[model samples]
Target: MTAADGVAATVDLNGNFPASPPGSRSKKMVRDGPQPPADPTAVGVKKSGVLWADLDPCDEGRAPTVNGGHADTASGANGANGANGANGANGHHAGHDDGAPDGVPAASDRIDGVLEMLETHPESRVLVLYTGGTIGMVRDQSGALAPLRNRLASRLRSSPTFHDQEYAKRRFGDSDTGPLILPVSSEGRRVLYTIREYDPLLDSSCMGIEDWVRIATDIKAHYEQYDGFLVLHGTDTLAYTSSALSFMLENLGKSVIVTGSQIPLWELRSDGRDNLLVSLLLAGCYVIPEVTVMFGARLLRGNRTVKVSADSLRAFDSPNFPPLATIGINIDVDYRLLHRPKATEPFKVHCKMGSNVGVLRIFPNIPTTAIQSFLAPPLKGAVLQTYGAGNIPGNRVDLLEALREAADRGVILVNCTQCTHGRVAEVYAMGKVLWDIGVVAGADMTPEAALSKLSYVLSKDEWDLATKKEMLRCSLRGELTAPARVLADWDDLDAVVRALGAKPSQTASLLVPAVTCAAAARRGAGPLQAVIDAGADPAAATMEGRTPLHVAAYEGNLEAVRLLLRHGAGVHAKDRFGRTPLVDAVQMDRHEVIAALRGSGAHLGAANPALGDKLCSVAAVGDVQRLESYRLAGTDLCQRDTCGRTPLHVAAQMGRSAAALFLVSSGVDVAAKDLSGLTPAELASAAGHHALANALRSRRSNFCT
Candidate 1:
């Protein structure tokens, strides 16, 4: 199928393409015409289509007529109406000059017309390698969809959904050479991309180790020219390709996204648009240096993914690991979870891949002969999917003997769990038996990661067996979590302290917040008593001036409060907010803690005469009655703290909805700005309190009226 045929099929599927009005040239003529002029006035105007009036800026009263006719310069005369133009080839209204009077161009004109504006802006260059995928599939003469070679670029250029004429008009001319340029605006920068489609594209199911090597080699060739890359592929084996690429590319310092869709782009309800658009944007804009799979609004580490469903749109998941990023109204990236590449390391590719690895799933009633046949010669490594927690039936001595024989024959066997989650460890007696027989534990690694890593390891001919075993246990490319330290004996608490990087005598000097210690008490009495018995100070205060007693009282931790008081913790201590333990307990409605604090001689109200701190404290704890009392006492309603946060700001930021409602009812300034110039409503929105923010906005509007 030709590219034009693909585009025509898409247009027929949608039935959205409008015909040209009378006297206008055909859509084909627009594409064949000379390139539009560089001037902003002529940039988005389709010369063969509608005739539009270009309003005069100097003489605002007059509007220019169609066909280059002039109107009255001073009478503010209206010109004769021209035929309405059909939608432009780029999916924008052509020659509609409504915005010409205000000096702001129409949406269609702004598509690629922003080139001059982008001259001073930074550009992120992306290279998209379009391999065969559903995104590039087109129907043939018999109406069956298939991969079309040399048609992807043409289809993209002709489709308004992919190519915005205005955006195309803004290309940085005479500066570079490559395929199609796609413009994307994100994060205050312009992303320009070039698409390079592969010849005789192979389906993802047919993709192999050699194909992975080819992809890696291509990236290595163009590494210096582009900032990032996007690979369009079939979804059947997308996860495998991503995994292979992850290991094949070493010390990669740029983002490489593997993405495809289940639906073809020529369909009306296709998911290809969002998937391709987001992949392009992320590739061009972000600095994530790992091979990742972008699908179903998630950015997952490629090696950790598995195809969980064949029919669902959300077909892939990283069961053992959380996604690195999630896409919503905003793109939320967990930077702490992302692996940061060292600046000193240079990018390289390891093209050699071992293909002799296999997977064996253990099941009940399995014959010993079957196991031996599978583990026969030529299998360099195998991933044994053992029962829960890496356990095989110990009573099946014959099966165990076959595995032992395989190991004795120098075959590397990795033990992973059949379950989607949890780690394989020597918790069971059967597990210990496998461990004793030279089976390596694939701790918390998904099957995909285990198999891929095994192949990658066996391919390294220079490395010895011991080195490969050690590397298997260690985390090498963020593929697996390192094995945790097993401190079997806790008889010596001092040793535990030393292991935690603290001296026995200095244990009490631990600077962890007292509130955190109080929260930790909920886990068990053992950890709390260990800290206390190790000479930990019960009166330690965080930088916020909150003591263990204050946090205990607020959290209603009765035993923790008793322990702190018995250990010489002060009763009259005040926080930096001028709040006492009694105040915190009372505001939190912890009746037991309130009684205990009162018995310890704690007092209520602020520790000082600062009205801002007192009001903010009351609002933070939802003490509506106390706030009302302060308002009745003639205290400033809009008082601000040292941080310039008003009581309303405090209530909104802390999600104290009732307190915010009370303050609003008391006629407080809802529009009062904080130190950062955000109003209470904006603070609530930033804090993710949508209901509170909406209420505040509604109240502010009512007050303004």
Candidate 2:
């Protein structure tokens, strides 16, 4: 059997046919000379001439036949059989050849079959760009495996496991095209995809900035034609390509999935089939918007991924981030984790990627000369993989001097963590040394992300060094975690809060103290202590006589309340309405705040004539312990407030699940009508708490029981 026949026979085809001599294999033609770099700024080994292959007609027109049906007279006959198919004797049966040449199938019959497969209108369309990878690798005459353009699409077309014939015919009626439509039924939605193999397929190791730019440009060229895109790339530098693409494509509103496999698709137990199938499904059905890597049943942010294994099928991981979606019996996407595109923003490609970046992994007893040489001229930026939390050797003054010299020469250095997880924190003494010397903290950015981001940042020639440095620290396309803001002083804190557009306090005289105290309370002990030490009164009261302790308790700031109590703040201090800190805590349903206050000797205020108000406050806080205490103290749970709202009404309106459940369990009236003549369920529904509304409805039946 010819090699092509050998390769084709390994696939599980659905129909049966008499085997014939294999057709001619497409010649792998190498392009003439090295192609000029696509991006002017791209600096790397120039790619060789494009590998060219004739388009395989089988991919676009092959049709599945039933039983021992006659082969399409238009298409060529089946290639010679090799060993039995992977599915044993039931292995894909080939159609019987008509009155055609020994190895050639009739073209007219093939066209008729193709037309039949084109019956169904696609629900969704994905453009798969097969750049080149192990997924398409085939053994050459020398028996060495190498990527053969058009081979991947051919294998997928011939495989019944991938292109289910019976499922397609049942779902989609006879059409103009053969069963060429690849369908992925996910979440009850079917996705149809087409593959466009790149001419001169690339080995990912040879991929550079220009290739990334080319891919981005291709997507831009076809952005409006398809719903999403899938890139078949080599695994070696797949992460780098994905990372680069993440930066290159800005405001991408559709999924761009990069996937590959360790084993070739022709292998009996290859991962390529699943990877390709999943990538196609994700690209066609999901709106991930960002470039992502879908592999081993996990969809990760493209820029966040790193190839962690060379031999395992689960070869990639996002060390510092979680997978955006996990594939199981169902595709479970974390919608909250997805980055939604702004409606006002249009998708655009930023193809100008700078390639003059390098990575320097520091090691024990590493020499200063090596660092200087690596950071020499032409290298615009470098990712410095440092020790834990971005620390370097403190004793290595020479190495520090080398880094300082590089920084002085305008070489931007990004300090990234050597560890897979955690971030580069400037806590260690050596870490501070790097920070002081102008190294931009890479935060939790993966090495792939850092390197690509640096290249992207440096490509912006119009921006000043300071701006580039700032952008490096900032998260442009969800590549890195932005560092937490550390307020320098109270003024800085106030400025930030004001920027949030909070309304100013109404009482001018008490406004400053009240706002300051409230802000401190929200920030917990650190800022609260700073404010107190800065001469702000711990006992300072608002116009409503609400002190810092009351605000702290209402915010559930246990540490802030403790700090206030330790600073001689009054435990029984009452607000303008005669509400103590404990009352405020109860009103907010802050159990921890109440526990802290109760531990500090704070007591529930004396029984007021407004006993209904106290009960509602207790219910609003959802503190069952506090509610029990009030019940034991003879406060009626069924008491109605001035508005005739019961504790249950308040709990429902607040959407306090815990309190509502507690009230229901205590047999409080679930049918109790509020001031508005609405039951707890109605009140919850009106408040847009559907889950709580349902719960209340369920409990109402229990109450009847």
Which residue pairs does candidate 1 place in steric collision?
A: 111-166, 111-167, 112-166, 112-167
True-structure RMSD for candidate 1: 25.0
Query: What TM value does model 1 have?
Result: 0.53
Model 1 misses residue 291 by how many Å?
Answer: 0.5
Candidate 1 lDDT, 554-630, residue by residue in tens: 66687776666555455545454334455555444566655565454343421121234345655656667656545
Deviation of model 1 at 154, angstroms: 1.8
Estimate the TM-score of every prediction.
0.53, 0.51
Report the C-alpha lDDT of model 2 over 1-705, residue by residue, as the tens digit.
211111111111233221211231221211111111121111110011111111111111112221134311111121122111222223343333334466543432332332223222223456788899887898889988898765765567566655655544433333323323454364333455567788899888888888888899999886744557899999999999999999888656568999999998788898988888888778766556689998999999999999999999999999988899999998877543555332223467888888789999999999888988999999889999999999999989999999999999999999999998899998899999998999999999999999999999999889999999999998877788643323223443554456556523322223446655666467668888876666555666664556788778767788887787666565545443334576566655577766666655454422221344445544555657766655433345666543355667767765778888877776678887743356777766755678998988876533321
